[model samples]
Target: MPRPRGHPRSLRARPELQRLEPKVLLTTFTLTSPTRGALLPAGVSPVGGIVIDLIGEGGSRVVSQIRARDLFVGDFEGGNPPESRGNPGTIGERPGFSPAVVDALGGALAELSVRLTVDDGDTGPGDFDRDDNTLLLNGIAVGRFDRVPTVETDASGTAILSENPEGGFRNDRVDTGFFHVTDPEVLRLVLDSIRDTGAIVVQLLDDDPGDNFFDFTVGIDAALIDVDLPPEPQNRSPRITSLRVEEPVVEGRPSRVIVSASDPDADDAITFRFALEGDGRIEPSETPGEAWLTVPRDGTVRLSVRVEDDRGAFDEAGRAVVVRNAAPSVTVAADQDAIEGREAILAIGSFDDPGLEDGWSVAVDWGDGSAVETFPVDRPGPIPPRPHRYLQDGDYSVTVRVSDGADASEASALVRVRNAPPALQQVLAPRRVTLGTPVDLAAAVSDPGILDPLTVSIDWGAGEPSRIDLPPGSTAFESAFLYDRIGSFVITVTVSDDRQESAVLGVPVTVEAPEPVPPAQAADQALAEALLPADPADPRPATLAIAPDGPGRPAPAPSPSPATLAAPIATLVGQDAPDPAPRASSPPPIPVEAPSAVVSAEQTAPAAPPPPTESAGVAAGSAEAPDAAAVGPEAIASASPSPAVVDPGPDPDPDATMAPETATVAPAVGAADAAEAASSTAVAAGDDDPGAETRSGAMRATVLIVAALTVRRGGSRIRQSLRSASVRSARS
Candidate 1:
């Protein structure tokens, strides 16, 4: 035989005689002894060819009948058996084969089929004619014209082999119809048949059950599917419930904006971020619920409030707020003119705002250095005027400042004050008067704005003045100046109010010396004197006296006889002498001489009693006769008689009778004689002469006559006698 293409050379060289020899190829065998079985030998090559060899006496010469149905050929090893271990080929047995060989043969056939398929060609009864006897080399049928061989079992249980000189196995003879009988019953029958055809003996060892094979031609189809997802949660918008501003809309100040929302799933509260319409900067607020933003002095600002939820959803709300540029207005006025040292009240007016409840105030500056006062208007009412007093005196600018809630305004006034001159009034009376005379001075003035008049004083240019009430309509006054000294003096009078004084007014007064002492008797002088004393030598008399001379007798003969004369002239000069003499002698007894020639009756009549003399004598008649009888010639001669022939002086009657001359003479003589006798006796006793006595007596008679004549000439000798007796008694 030639090797095929790409075959090895070791499989190509063999002798023709070896190829033609009948090699007792055990194609089929049956066992009559012990049991039916099959043999699997090495180096057998076929798809499905069963080879048998006889052995063991109990494995009798059993006539094994091989049927075509009992033999299989192909690559039996490629077929899986029904059991988990492996699939064994079936071998049919004749009835004469023992049960043991039947079982052994069945296993041997399966083994030989597996070995033959791996090594030789398939040789079985079914692979050739059934009635013909055949011989084979190995399991291949011998032929010259390509004829298949057939085999038969003799009674001795020998296999008769025959070859057919005909075309048999094809060149491409593949047993494509090889089927593995996994049915246990069918597989047992095939084993029985192999046991009976026991030319080759088989021993029943452990079965190699085949792996369980499943034809999983059916599959499941899988794909990834997608369904639509729920729509994403939408962002919720924030709500603005209320908006409020904390402060009044001052143009440039920061204000607060508050926003609210109703997001249950909110992670952050709403915040308001603000921006002015014209500004460039954006300010962020820190407050979560409310935000305060500074407003600019411009247009309205846009406020955006944003709130964010936990699901990363955000929402925003917006609003606009306006900012104004103008501030509040203020005006001020005063209730009175601005005067120095006087109160001025100020009234304030201002704009109103509800946000700023405590509104405006007023301050008054009185142009003096003083503190300012402030007022607050928290409610609706009139603002009390602020009063200020300026201490200085001059033109002053009084400033009043009124304030709004935010700012202030000012106004001023000019206050003029003229200096108040002191009020002056002069008080005086009798503008002119004699010096040293009293005059009244008074004044009437009024300071209506100052204290009372008692507080004022007067200065009369003299000293402090005494207070006085002013008379009606009198402004100037006069007071006494006893200007005893002669000169001119200016009287200056001034009136004073406490704050100021009046100008001095000079009143010139010329004081003259008083008129010389007026005559004392003058009307005015009398008055003056009444007030003074009287003069000493006022030679004026108050009374006067007169005297007359004696009566008759031709002034009584300037010269009389010395006897007739009275006493000596010295005696006549004496303060004691009686002015008139007394008649001491009795009346003459003589009658008046008759007209006829008769002797004078006086010569013839008796004489009166005589005045007693120092000598004792009684004159009786006639001036010469001491007594008629005694009338001697000598006595008569001795007596100084008057010259005779005398007429009777102033006798109213001449016829008066004459007394008897004789009787008158007798008594006188007797008286003389007695005196003589007594004297004689005294002489005898040593007495002086009686005749001398008589003559002495006669002288005594004449002395008596003279004394009587003196008495008669003088008046009243009785007064002289009484004056003499009173002197004698006083002396005694």
Candidate 2:
């Protein structure tokens, strides 16, 4: 059998060609000729045949052809005469046939066929012609034809070749059926033979010998062949067009999954299936290609959906979903006390599912008719505190809410707002502090609400108060100051919370001055007191006139002789010194002088007492002596009582009381002597002469006055004796 003409040679490498399955290559040919007016044998106007050539890349060739004599068989100028032209019979209808020679070589052959034609001129040589053809395979006779067209003859009895008066051949179209080796084993041998030998040949031949004598003109209009190639299996796995699942899968909660699939082969039937390998359960839904699922507690859920075609072609798609717990729990806290115009802090906390605690967001409400605030939380534990300030005093509440977009929770707390003025709890200070002394002062200051920052200060009377700032929530404060001046001072302590409110407290302190000392005197105090009597009738009158050197009094005039000097009359024995001196016979006694200035009365009682001195004899008469006995009755009657002398009390033993003046000279004699001097001196002068008597009394009083001054200068013992003597004298 002939191979198909114009088969494409293999363009692949040897290894690629081996990979290709063996199959017959099909081709078709339309035959035509450019040689039109060639000389022909008698009774044969024109004849033609067609041959096809196939060339391979490896320098191989294959050929196939259509025979001309197989169609239009006739004999005219030769021995046989032509029969009627119009009637022809069919060829390929019979069933019985002998196998060709090439059928033994696996009988893989390409087929060939031809159509015969005849035409007349314009005068009409042949007007009607039927298409009749013979088919050939590998040069073997395969088909016989009988249909043909006939031409009318003119009076000359000649067949027309053209209908045109100008003379031209007929033009028409015809078809040849396809033929080729289709058996797998036969096609494989054929392809192998061609590949090995590098070539194969096909030819066409006229099977009727008598028809060949007419040299019938044959034309191959077309040739076609079938190949051993069937369509590719066309079995394609189904493709997963789309896969989807409901988002945010939660533990122990049902989720939905949707899957879609398609196959390239439209006629293929497909079935869908689903699987969940871990952390979840999956089941097919009532609808096709859909499923329902529940995830396990925490972790990933792996899901796979598969689609299978009727031809066993299949495809699958997989997905992973992470499951989490429920909504988060939130809590908020803040300081209970809040002060107006002060800042307060509120803290937040949240707890989420065990493995899913990371991402979150928070919103807060200050509960004071203000907008809510929101922020994202990057950390999982306690959140940083948020700060807020209140402008007015009132009670306020706070809230904090947390969310993970899908779930949320919240917590709340309360904050108390108050305009608590600064308070001074206690001032630790001293009452009596000395000038120039640094006193430690401390004040316990506090705010009952808000615990806002406070300032504590102390005004230390002398200057501006020193101040110290306290941080929020502080209580006690202290400082020190030195008072520069001394007096009653008021200390003020002021405490402020820096929030337009403050408090103050005050304290008192006192100071004093020193005392002065008195000067000492040298006069005798006891004698002087006796001279200046309290009673009007007493000797005070005489004493004031006669006693020249009494307390706060001036000294008497000095005389030439000591005995006549009244100023020295205090030198009298047994009396304070300054007693009158006695007169002498021959020589005048040395003059006695008086002190320059009057002594202070307080100096009479000196700090220390003087030693006792022996008694000195008083003058009985002197140049200036006067006689008290001669005084007139009027002078005597008018005389006040002598100074009340401090009398020494008589001793229980008479002898002691009568003891000599020398024995009592220490203190007792002074008192007694002062008393008697007034009278004794008077008596010793004249008792009959009134003028002399008055003069004597006056002199005596002067001596007593000086003696009293000396007694006062002595100690407490001497003073007691004076008192005793004064009492006795008064009694006497």
Clashes of each: 89, 63
Best-fitting candidate, scored by lDDT: 2
> Per-residue alpha-carbon lDDT of model 2 for 1-732, expressed as tens digits?
233444321111111111112432211111211111011112211123323222222212233333433333443223222331222211111111123212222333222122223322111224222123233333233332222222222211122222232212233322111223323444455444544443332222323222322222322222211111111112444667778888777766677888888765678888888888875678888888888888746677788887877866566678777777666666566547777657877565454433344567888888887789899887556778778877656777778888766678888878888786867889878887666667788777767644467777777777767988888777788798776667877788888775668899997765333323322312433333323322222121121111212333542222121111111112222222222345433122212111111121123311211222223222221222133222111100001122222222333321112111110112212222333433443453345444445544443443343333223222343323323222222223
Stretches of candidate 2 off by over 4 Å are 1-256, 261-273, 283-287, 292-301, 306-426, 433-454, 459-490, 500-505, 513-732
Best by TM-score: 2
What local lDDT score does residue 11 receive in model 2, on the 0 to 100 scale? 19
Model 1, span 376-464: residue lDDT tens: 66543344656565543457566766555455556665655333333455544445555565445544454332322323333334434
Query: Residue 431 error for model 2, in Å?
Result: 2.0
What residue runs in model 1 are displaced by over 4 Å at the alpha carbon?
1-314, 317-329, 334-336, 339-355, 359-361, 374-376, 379-382, 388-393, 401-421, 425-732
Q: Which ten contiguous residues of candidate 2 have the minimum total lDDT?
A: 631-640
